[model samples]
Target: MNQLLWMAVGAGAVLSIEGLYWLYWRYVGSGSVRDYINEDQEPEGDYRILRKIKTPNQRIALVEYRGQMWIYGNGDVMFSTTEDENMYAEAMVHIPMAAAGKRNKVLIIGGGGGVTTREALRYSEVEEITAVDVDDVMLEFGKHLEAMVRFNRGSLNHPKVRTVIEDGRTFIENTPMKWDVIVIDVPEPTGRYPRLSRLFSVEFYRLLKERLEPEGAINIACSTSFWMPEYFWSIQETLKKAGFQVLPFHHFVPEDGEDWAFCLATTSPVDTDGLRMLVSTEYLTPERLKDMFYMPFYFANGQNQGDIQTDDNTVLLDIVSEADYEQDGNRKEYN
Candidate 1:
């Protein structure tokens, strides 16, 4: 009987080890399901390849991962359909438009899918919108994808919307004219690409600050509240150090299973009151604006909680460490 009990204990230990190995391989080692799939060869509607298109410049794919449409360019998944893409586009574009008080001559830095351009045109007061996106294939795929096209119907073909195929950083550096409103809709910095990392740097925000009109606002998609607290704070701090009054806001995206944050920094305060006045088709009301500022204790406490910022160094790394601790604690409790 003792021999049998010992044998059972040994088998249980082996099974436990195997279970841990599988969990690690599934979550961290293999990366997310959205990241691993090669959209080029994946057949459409096969629980993969939501849609695929190849343009002259690059290959783009749209896949339904995590219950939202994700745009992949040159094998890199760019923006996902977070929140209602329409609601997000409307809030980002219209808030700044109303704040600017003049809609003519706008510059959209990264809205390749044309959602922002569509919302910008809704006012009818805006004369021209120059949209600069690095991925040309994304535009092509979006045009062909019925649901995507429907999101911004007729806006891509609108006479006022001129699509400029170029890098956003290069466009900003070389463009001669100043913009009334500059909507920066770039992806979060994952350290995957050096150019993406540069967007979060102090120098880059300074360049963006220089290009803006005295009252013009820059709206950037910040990182998720869950995965990267350090990244979000670093971005906010970098913008603040670059000399803009920063206002941070978040919107919940059910499909992404995360609350996405956005930072609006400008020489002038963003007209939250003016934004409240807009005839919103969605639910971005004054109360909602207030709610966006409310962060949970875990996220709020993790911000500068256990970090020391010196003159020579930034607290980005420390903030990330605290966030990780909180995330792991929550995971353990739930599991």
Candidate 2:
């Protein structure tokens, strides 16, 4: 009976030790062993940004994580792989460039990967491209990375392409020249840097409005359709208030779950038929343009209203709070 009691105590002690080890591994030591192995391997498909290269500005080392690529900017995971860099760049750049009709002088804000610049140059109509990125290392990585360079097709070194290492907001504020089209591909707002947050602010959109040519348009990378509904609507509302006729659209990215949203704003009407003439891709079509305008009920319900107090007023702030009221017990309001 004493031996049996000893055996039970021994078993209990072993279980306790194992439980403590598990907790330490799970919370403190590191992630799971599988994650550790994946990190060491740096697998191709599941790329994530492990660290930021601060010497040459805030450039990120993107690696595969959980079957998706994530970009770490300044030790924070800024962007996650929702769609391929090529696909996202193409949509963000091509759509606005095509809609603008003639691309004379283009300005790209926050396209660290150089993907947007690559896509913009695809239109032979473009005379010059001014790409403003805060990180120089991102450009270096884009040049060296076979997949990224191949996808961009050496557009980064195009004759008309001139690289400018500067903050987008500062550049916009100081530059006297107007652009035919402006594409903003900056990080999402975590409310850390007010400049990045300002992109979604009324003042920033107003600045964009000022810099745009009469017929020119702008495209902004909003945010994930799934996670941050309020952030997305706020941007759309702010753009509208800044005197732009805003069209919020989204596409599915396999890396990022569900759907991704982008806001395209213009002073002039978009000639979807005319825009379709420039692209030879399977994605952009007249039919697709028509479909792009059709907002989902959940998204559409968030549009800004005239009376609602919002970050912007010129454009309708889709009253998302009311939508929350309507949703009642069904959905929780996204922060």
Candidate 3:
């Protein structure tokens, strides 16, 4: 009977060790294993999953981390409860507005979580904001998700805001209103993003420029300058083809994990004179703004590496795919 009791205790010890290892793997190791899991698990510590949903359109998740909520969609960080001037969303919104020199009426295309609208609302001169997003699911996240609504500072339902569920190209084609600033805050064109190719095409830029008021400027969310330098160059050339003077700039967004590029294009000359920030920004000093427009000499050497995207010829996807695959290869080699 004593021997049997010792065996039982030994089995319990083994079971306890295995159980602890399993918990560690599930919480920590799972994140490191490639293809081990499709989604992120609830992180350790104060971070907790408030809600997670995988819709046909995209995966939406809300998590509380460091005393704030972060919204992720399709593995990309979308919005966070932390509102700082250095955040990418805030800087992107304010950049074009500053370049425009007027914030009277604004139109935001592909504003997934209403964060851009929230930033735009900081300008009292912004009379109305129309946020057009193709995905109703994303708009619903902005509207129904408590954490998301809080991050957007109630701008989703603000009197100055109007949410429209429509394709950005179609909205620009049909809307009668002209905007002083048009902000394109859509997802990047990489990784199975649907219908984003045409949005980056020359045809789309022409349509966007048509909806801009005279002296108005448009800002497009080009991909990261680090991994996707060619992508930014292609956009600059494409915008020039559409008859707008392009000024390329980049901001390092901590949540994005890279330095993101934004292109400010205008039918008229881009005038920095009298440029003033209506809203306080953390990273966009006047000196920094001037420096952001300068491209490294190496990038300028290969201006025509790829064809500019058009309605008939969509090649931005291929370019982004190639760049991303190269990054994957480098990662594998390092490993």
Candidate 4:
């Protein structure tokens, strides 16, 4: 019996050591997914990775899915869609722009693919489009890549457009130019991406309020209210605390596999009665704009008990990290 017990203990120790090593080798030792897969061979079954870009900040992958191209940052699909409709981009820029009425100088933060800038240029009133992003690699992709340039209507290279490779918040802090329409198209306030969540904080919004024209309006991509409601409303509350009258709205994005929320904030009244498009678009209409503003009961009351995000408090990260959300495209279970 003693000998049998010794053998059992020895076996368990060996198995545990082997399991730990396997984990390290698979995750830590392996540099990235690109390192494991052969570049020449199609490794993701239905989806094929065309190119992978390594920046100091993140790993970017240009993927081809069902004959369509998608840009993914750190395993998540970017908000910009390749489709002509580009519902997300149109909705984010136009409604607030229409409200502002005479927006000449527009500021876009985190315009990764230049799609947001593309939508902004549709307004004939917009004279200058300043796109600021921390990732120069992404900016270069927007400037030169055939697929990205095609979808973005060559907005990055447009004479009226200027691309700045700097942290959005830092640029805003230093720039003397007060913008007419400010569009915040950043990633979700999750831990995977660093420093960006700070953009959603009250202090940061206050900085935005400082740079914004009195009559100017701001729009933000507020992540998924369908799954992570707490994170959504906390951001809504943070914006309000920053001294702006806020209007929270949402739309279903097929790429994200959920309903994504957005906040339209203004120093003045949000009177979009005169909303009209200066250029042609496939998706956004007056009727649809009315529907987009409708928030359901669950989404309206999402912030049950949470403090506003602050520079020192770190509340948003705690909430975002604890939330259980599913992004369909991020996993092997893409449908």
CA lDDT, every model vs. true structure: 0.65, 0.65, 0.73, 0.75
Off by over 4 Å in 4: 1-45, 79-81, 253-257, 272-278, 302-306, 325-335
lDDT of 1 by residue, 1-335 (tens): 99999999999999999999887764456533334343332324635555556565445667775556677754554555554566677667765666664667788887778788877877766888888887776665445556667667756668888888887878877876787788888754332333455555676678888888777877777656555555666677778778888777777766646576777777877655446535555756678766766665434534432322232443554444455466646632210
Better of 2 and 4 by lDDT: 4
> Candidate 4's residue-wise lDDT over 36-83, tens digit each?
232322224677667877787777877776766677675566633446
Candidate 4 similarity to native, TM-score:
0.81
Error of 4 at 190 (Å): 2.7
TM-score, per-candidate, Cα-based: 0.71, 0.72, 0.80, 0.81
Query: Where does model 1 exceed 4 Å of error?
Result: 1-46, 50-59, 64-69, 73-83, 253-257, 270-275, 298-335
lDDT for 334 in candidate 1 is 12
Candidate 3: clashing pairs of residues:
none
Q: Give RMSD (Å) of candidate 4 vs. truth.
A: 8.0
The sequence of per-residue lDDT tens digits that candidate 3 reaches over residues 249-330 is 7765465355667888988776664566666776677776665665555344244454688877657777767765676466
Clashing pairs in model 4, backbone N/Cα/C closer than 3 A: none
| Residue-pair clashes per candidate | 0, 18, 0, 0
Between which residue pairs do clashes occur in model 1?
Answer: none
Compare candidates 2 and 4 on TM-score and give the better one. Answer: 4
